[model samples]
Target: MSAGPSADDVPAPDPRLVADLRADLAAVGGDGYRVDAVTALLGLVADAALHREQPLAARRVVTAAVGAGDPLAALVGAFVLGLEVPSDVLATALPRCGLDGAGRLGLLEAVPGGRARARLELRPYAAVDAAGGADWWVASDLGETATGGPLRTDHVLGVGGASTTLARAVVREPVDRALDLGTGCGVQALHLRRHARSVVATDVSARALRVAALTLALDGGAGGDRPGEDGAAPGRGTVDLRRGSLLAPVAGEAFDLVVSNPPFVITPRTDGVPAYEYRDGGMVGDALVQHLVEDVGGVLAPGGTAQMLGNWEHRDGEPWTDRVGAWLDASGLDGWVVQRDLLDPAAYAETWVRDGGQREGAAFDALVGAWLDDLAGRRVDAVGLGLVVLRRPVDPSRPRLRRLEEVPGTGSGALGAHVADVLAAEEQLAGLDDAALARRHLVVAPDVTEERHARPGAADPEVVLLRQGGGFGRAVRVGTAVAGVVGACDGDLPLGVLVGAVAQLLGRPAEEVAAEVLPAARGLVADGLLRLA
Candidate 1:
């Protein structure tokens, strides 16, 4: 992989040239301004590319930007394209792309004259020198300012918190075949290509696919490889780009891994306005997410896994766990669903409406009101936000059905690894019965902790509490003998033998201790905080 230029290393374009180009652009007023401005911008990007040793990349960015439309829109399109442009020049050139004298454009700032502008100023592109590339992009969104106006009902968002969160949370393992569903600008697919041998990236929008293709091509070209090498077998690093609805393009094929950051927004689609290709999946009230979960089973190969970020309706009488559990059981796959966040229907509707730049108080509130009516009509009390991971069940006769509360904190690469670990454990213990489980000594995972709480002015003055540090931090209560047995677990002895010895040391009846300790140990094993040896 070849490295692009560093931010500090990029040379600033000549001020005299910029001044002359601006004057020329201003002179070509009315009908000619668009053409003149585009031409000048292309030249500037090309000049920067040449200075940073990537003239081809610069030209590609210019081409893509010219086709994307408008001054602000073209500028945003150019920035993503310019990822391949040597950074040494981009740092100095980016500020110039802004209309403000300060060279800093707030992504949340509304476009002039009620035009919908792309919020590309978010830290989707950052200069890094890792993996042998000077301008390797590091995803960031810290300095992002919130939308100030009412969100356009149909808005095309650039990179945001939810997008990056899903990207990082996706499992990045070496696999023979992979698929990225709803691949907006191909960010998820771009990350998948790093590990998967072959990746098929699909989207419903031609424009999104075009941008994704360009991103792949530029990034690959700058790294000295051809982009668009899709459909090739494992280890080839090829990505097949497809344009279609979810799973429709790859109907017959089964992949080792599949991932999606689908258009999961639960919003009301009114009248004839076209839904934003990037955000709306055209299904009503969590239907898109439900469809993905239901259909993914048909495409995942045996031993394969699928990970998705989804939202589901939380009806008044239904427990979120029961709703998700039903989906998993019906899918015929061993699955784990972690509900990361919850929002009441009104709160959820308002949050997303504002997200699209619909911040005008009454207008935004009205839009949100419409969404709540839709949800209420559908019996949706709230929305459950979550990450779901599924593994194709090996046994047809018996399928795994497990649903737990959400894991705390943001799910990232480490969380992906944790899911992989959980799957491995499930497989290892698939057929083990009580006798076999007793023979294996399970260690209380390091993430499990015990706490003692003291009560004042009480007959029974103390309580012992068991807490799991990872996953959902589920709490349990246990006796001293069970705690000692857990503490001594170092993968050194069988459970039966360890419990037997502990009972003797504590002067507790062996049978009595066995009844209490065994169930707690089994529960720990099932929760994946303990590894059964």
Candidate 2:
């Protein structure tokens, strides 16, 4: 595999050029470029090829992006098209920054005949979170699609699928302080500012931190301690960029929320197989993820929450839950873990090796073999990928809520509100006794629906399911008594009274029916299907 640019090659984007670039991006129209526009520009065949990590088809569109008068087209050619453009074309694209400023920003390198090629990938990014929609520019090392080769060890990542996943998963309620651990390119930090009063983004790689600082600067939320125009001190747009691994930089300091899309990829420790710092944590097996699970709560204030994306190894005899459960137990924090994907050894090996841009060649085969050997040595059968949301209990005397399950298709979209609601429910349920819970009136959530299925010739339904229309889309199988109880919950009567009425209709003891249905009711509330009125 051929190597791409090193971390040292990434130069600090000047704030002045950042301002000019921001203006240039705005002049081209909203958010610079959209996915649909690029797709239309590249056509179906070339777009599909580009999605498959091959840039040859995209390279064919070089003339289109460069020759067009739109600054969007010229900017696309210079960066996304991966083509050297004439100095005049670049100047036309970024009239304020110009080629000289681009070169100063280390985004482009001067070539022969006054032509310049992009040394890095810089583009506009747009997103809609709980706060609403906004756009910003981001710069990171060129990927395999841009370079058509392997990535450097410390490649600063751009906004990709994983970045967006964590961004949407983050709980977006206003808070006093927030921290973005292992904040590569500072994408999470940028999003955190939407809700957090102050955000501190930290990373182990100094180069990554520099790139992250540039990313925030380009986005208008420039990091540092500078005061605002009115002299009231910087607010939402200000971030404190720090350099450290895990939570060491902010040790003993407490935060209301924390988010991370860490280097949780499980890689083998074998010779000739390069461990990329962006993904690998330089630890054996899944130790890095385990360590985070065991320690992230130390910096969290009471009732604070942390969300992260990670991977765990599964041995032959033990279940995936057992592996992750142990880590949660060690942390002593209330946690809800959702395993999103699982991959066998072969599939896992191919995914990572190819992720490093190594095709199905001898090197790829060798790396796969090493990965398999490493797994075999540990008696591993498969790997589980998931999202974990943890919280430090406000009442230390209460037992921590521990929930571990697999949700392969939790569906897509922002889950910040759903997660926050679940945590809140857990706290509420933990505080309430059985008598107190039964006395409270409840209502079914707006997004919940009931479905009944029966045999073709049958008159009465045999199966009943309560499905959530949004927020994790959980479907709960309900028995006759529970189904009736849930159907009657409309914020009018207390749960105990409803249970008594149902028990009378079924000719059963109220105490016996209450014992059976109350647990399920609590579960429904915890998952956001039902709420206290």
Per-candidate clashes, comma-separated: 15, 0
Tens digit of per-residue lDDT, candidate 2, span 23-66: 77666534455555666677899879877767787776756666
lDDT of 2 at 344: 96
TM-score of model number 2: 0.92
Q: What stretches of model 2 exceed 4 Å from their correct place?
A: 1-5, 29-31, 34-58, 221-237
Which lDDT tens digits does candidate 1 get at residues 503-524?
A: 9998988887788777777766
* lDDT value, candidate 2, whole model: 0.81
Top-scoring candidate (TM-score) = 2
By how many angstroms RMSD does model 2 differ from the true structure? 3.0
Each prediction's Cα RMSD? Answer: 12.3, 3.0
